[model samples]
Target: MIEWLLLLLPVAAASGWLAGKRSAETVNADSHSQLNSAYFAGLNHLLNEQPDKAIDTLLNALKVDSDTVEPYLALGNLFRRRGEVDRAIRVHQNLIERPYLSSSQRGQALLELGLDYMRAGMLDRAESSFLEVLKRRSHIGITLRQLLDLYQQEKNWHQAIAMAQKLHEESGEATESMIAHFYCELAEQHWAQKKAVETTRFIKQALASDWRCVRATLLQSSLAMEKGDYKRAIRCLRQVERQDPDYLPEILKPLSECYQYLEGQDKFFFWLTEASKRHPGCTSLVLARAAYLQQRGEQKEARYFLIEQLRVYPSVEALQQLLALGVPEDIEAASEPWSLIEEVASRLLKAKLNYVCGFCGFGGKYCYWQCPGCKRWGTVKPLAVGT
Candidate 1:
C-alpha cells in the first residue's frame, strides 16, 4: 500500500546515506553493491505483489547492520501491520538487546515491542514493557495511552484513571470524558458487588469528571429507583435530557416505571408532551405521547398525532405502536389490524439495532461500553427510533 511505500522511502534514503559515508573506505564498493542489490530485490518483490516476501527480504537485508536501528523499527512496524506480532516482537527485542543502540532508539524499540505484546494478547508483558518506557520518561504520551488501554482491557479502572490523568497532563488533551467512563466502570463493579456506598461514591466521581456523562446519570437513576426513591430517580433521569437528548430513549422505560410507581402518569404525560414540543418528530417522544393519549381514552387524538408525526418522519416503530392503540374490540376488525401491525412490527424489529457504535458504525442488538470495532469507550449509543 501507500503506507508501505512511504516506509520504504526512508530505508532507501538511509541506505544511500550509508553508502555515501563509506565512499572512502576499502570495503565500500562491496557493501554498496550488496545493499543495492538487496534493496532493488525487495522493491521488485513489492511491485510484484509479494509484500510478505518483500518484507522478509527487507528485514533480512537490514539485519546485516545491527547499527542501523531505523530500518529494524520500520520492519517491525511492517510485521505488526501484517499481523505478525511475534516477528515484530523478535525484531524489536533484538534491537533493544543491542548495547550499541542510543537511549532514544532503545526506548522506541521498547514502545514498539510493547505494542507487539498487546497485539499478541500478552497484556502482562505489554504492561511491564510500557511501564519500563514510562520510567525512562520517553514517549510519555504514547506510553500513557498504551497503559490506559491495558488497564481498560484488564478492567482495572483505578489504574486506567491514573494513566488517563497522566496522559492529560503530558499531552494537554482533555481526558475527562474517558476518565468519566472509568469512574462509571468502577461504579458498575461496586454496584454489582452490592457495595452501595462505594457505588454512589464512584458515580459522584463520574459526574464530577464529566457532568455530561449520560451513563453516570442513568446509573444514579437506577440506584435511586432500587432504593425506592422514585422522585430522585425521575429527577436523575430528567437530567439526561439536558445532558444529551440523544440518549432520551434510553431513559423512557425507566422514567415510566418511576412515574407508575409514584402514580404520576398525568405528570409523565405532561413531560412527554413538553419534550415532543421541543423535539418535534422525535420518534420515541412522539410514540410515547401517542400512547399516553390513547390511555386517556382519546383514540382520535392519538391517531391524529401519529398521522402528523408519520407525515413528517415516518418510523416503523411509531406505526406499530399506533396500530396497537387503534385495534378494535370486535374480533373481525381487530384481526385485520393486528395482522397488518404484526407485519410492520416484524419488519421494524428486523431493521432495528438496539445499539450502534458512533465511532465505528458497528450495530448490534445489545449495548457495548467499548466498541468492538474501534475499541473506543462510551461510543455506543441507543439507535435512534427513526433511523
Candidate 2:
C-alpha cells in the first residue's frame, strides 16, 4: 500500500503540473480547475485504501495527451511490478488507444502491454504484441528476446532457431550452444517417436550447431548401439569424454556396456585406463577399473585400488565398491534392511547426483537442457564435484 501511495503521489504531482501548464497557456481555466479537483480526489481515494476507486479516479482525471504518456507508462509498470497484470494491461491498452501518441510512444505502450500479457501467462497475446513491436523495429533486441523466450516455452524449436539466429546477428552474443540444445530437443522428440532417420539428421544438425555438444554424441551413440554398431557407439562415447570430461561418468556405464556387447572387456579396460590417467583421481574411472579387476579374479588388486582411491577422493560409490568386496557371495540378495545396505548406498549415490545446472546449482534426477532455475541452455550436465 505504501509503495502504491509512493507511486501515486508522483502521478498526482504530474497531474497538477499539467494543470498549471494549461493555466499558464490560458486555455480552459475552468477545465483546468476541474481537473485539479479530480486529481486531488484521486489522491484522497488512494490514501483511503480504495485502490480500485483511486485507479478509476486517476484514469478519469488525466486527459490522454502528449504530456501524460510518461505518467501512464510509469503507473502501468508499477502495477506490473505489483503483479496486477490486469490493471497494467488496461493502463497500457488505454495508452495505445490514444490516437495522438507518437509512433515510438505507442511502441513503448505495446511493449508494456505485451509484458503484462506475459506475466499473466497469456502467451499468445504477448507473442502477437512482441511481433507487432518487431515490425516497428523499435526495441528490436528486447522484442527478439521476448519472442525467443515465448517460442522456447512453447517448444517451437523451429521458430526459436530462427529467432536465435536473428538475435545473434543483431546482438553479437553467443547462442551456438543454445541452438545446439534446440536441435537436440528436436532430435529427442524424433527419437521418442521412433523416427531414427529424422533423429540422426537432427543429431547431426545439433553437432553442426555446436560440435562440442556431449548430448548429441550420447544420442548418436545410442542410435548406433540400437543398430548393433558397437564400434560406432564406442567412438561416439570416446568423443563425449573428450568433449566434456565432466560427463565421463555418464558415458562410462554406456561405454562399458558397448564394450561388453562387443565381447571386448580388454578394450573397455584400456579405455578406462586411458580416461583414469587423463582425469586422475576421478572416482568413477577408478571404480570402473576396480570392477574390471574383480571380474578378472584380481580381487586383491581391486581392493588395493579401491582403498588407495578412497583415501584420496572419498565418494559413496567408492565406499560401496570397497564394502562389496567384504560381502560374501552367499548372502541372499532379498534379505532385510541390513542386507539392503548396498542397495541403499548405491541409491544414495545416484540420488545425491543426477544433473546440476552450472548457472544456478540446480540439481535434479533428470536433465533439463534449460535450467529450471537460471534457464540457461546447455548448463545442466551430469553432476560432478566442482562442476
Candidate 3:
C-alpha cells in the first residue's frame, strides 16, 4: 500500500500540473474538470490500498500527448527502479501501443519495456525488444551494451563476441581483452566436449584477439602437454613471464613437469634462477628453486638461499620452509617444540589466501581466470607471498 502511494504521489502531481497548464493555455474548462475528477478517483483508490485500480485509472486519465508521454515514461522507469517490474512493463507497453507517439518516443518506451523484461528475468522478451530497438536505430549504444550483457548472461559466446565487436565499433571502447576472454570461454567449452580441433581453433582466436592473453597461452600449454609435446608446452609456459609476470607461480608446477618429462632439470633449474631474480619476493618461485636444490641433495645451499630471500623479503612461507629444512639432527629429544611450531605454521599457511581478485578484492584459496565476485576475466591473481 505504501509502495503504491509513493508511486501515485508523483503521478498525481504531474497530472495536477498538466491539468493547470492545459486549463491556462486553453479555455477547455470541461476537459480540465474531467481530468481532475479522474485524478481524484485514482488518488482515492491509492488511499484505499487498491493500487491496481489506481494505476489503471491514472494511466487511462493521462491522454498520450507530448506533455503526458514524458510523465508516463518517468512513472514506468520509477516502477522499474522500485522493483515493480510488472507495473513498469505495463506502462511502457501502453506507451508503445499509442499511435500518437513519435518514433523516438516509441523507441524510448520500447527500451524501457526491455529493461523491465530484463529485471523480471524474461530474457527472451528483453532480447527481442532490444533487437527491435536496434533495428529502429534508436539508442544504439545503450542497446548494444544491453545485448552484450544479455549474451554474456546466456553464455552465448559467439553472439557475445559479435556484440562486443559491434560495441567497440560503436563506442570506440577497447574490447580486445573481453573478446579474448569470450574466445577462451568457447575454447574451454569445446575442450570439455572433447572437440580438440575446435578447442585449439578458439584458443588461437583468443590469442589473436589479445596477444597478451595469459589464459589462452595457459590453455595452449595444457593442450600441448596432453599430447606429450613437452618442448612446446615448455615454450608456452615460459612465455607467461613475458605476458604477465604475476602469473609466474601458475606456470612453475607445469613448467617443472614439462622439464621433468624431457629430462631437462638443468635447463629448468637455470630458468627458475633467472625468473626468481627478475621477479623477487615471489614466494612460489623462491620455494620452487629451494625444492629443486633440495631434490639435488643441496640442502645446505637451499637453506642458505632461503635465508637470503627472507632477509630481503620476509615471508611466512619461507620461514616455514626454512623450519622444515632445518629440523635438528637430534630428532628424538628436540622434536616436541618443532612439532608444535610446525602445526601452527601449517594452520597459518592454510588460512592464507593464495589468490585474490585485483579488481574486486575477493580473496580465495584457488586461482580463477575469471573473478567470481566481479565476473571479470583474468582479474584474479596469485598473491605475492611476501610482506
Ranking by lDDT: 3, 2, 1
Clashing pairs in 2: none
Tell me the TM-score of each prediction against the true structure: 0.82, 0.89, 0.93
Clash pairs for candidate 1: none
Worst 10 residues of 3 by lDDT: 326-335
Model 2 stretches astray by more than 4 angstroms: 1-7, 22-28, 44-50, 327-351, 385-387
* True lDDT of residue 146, candidate 3: 87
Q: What is each predicted model's overall lDDT from 0 to 1?
A: 0.83, 0.85, 0.88
lDDT of 1 by residue, 1-387 (tens): 666677665765675456545643655677667667778888888678776677566556643343477767887898799897876887788778777777778788999999999999999999999999988888888899999989988989999999999898889989998999999999999899999999999999999999999999999999999999999999999999999787888989999999999999999999998987777767888878888888889998898889788888888777787677745455566476578767878787788888898878999988777789898878888776443
* TM-score quality measure for candidate 3: 0.93
lDDT of 3 at 237: 94
Off by over 4 Å in 3: 326-344, 385-387
- Global lDDT for candidate 3? 0.88
TM-score of 2: 0.89
Backbone clash count for every predicted candidate, in the order shown = 0, 0, 0
Of 1 and 2, the candidate ranking higher by TM-score: 2
* lDDT of candidate model 1 versus the reference: 0.83
**What is the per-residue lDDT of model 3 for residues 248-349, given as tens digits with 9 covering 90 to 100?**
888999999999999999999999888877877889889998999999999889988998998998887987998889774656546788788788888898
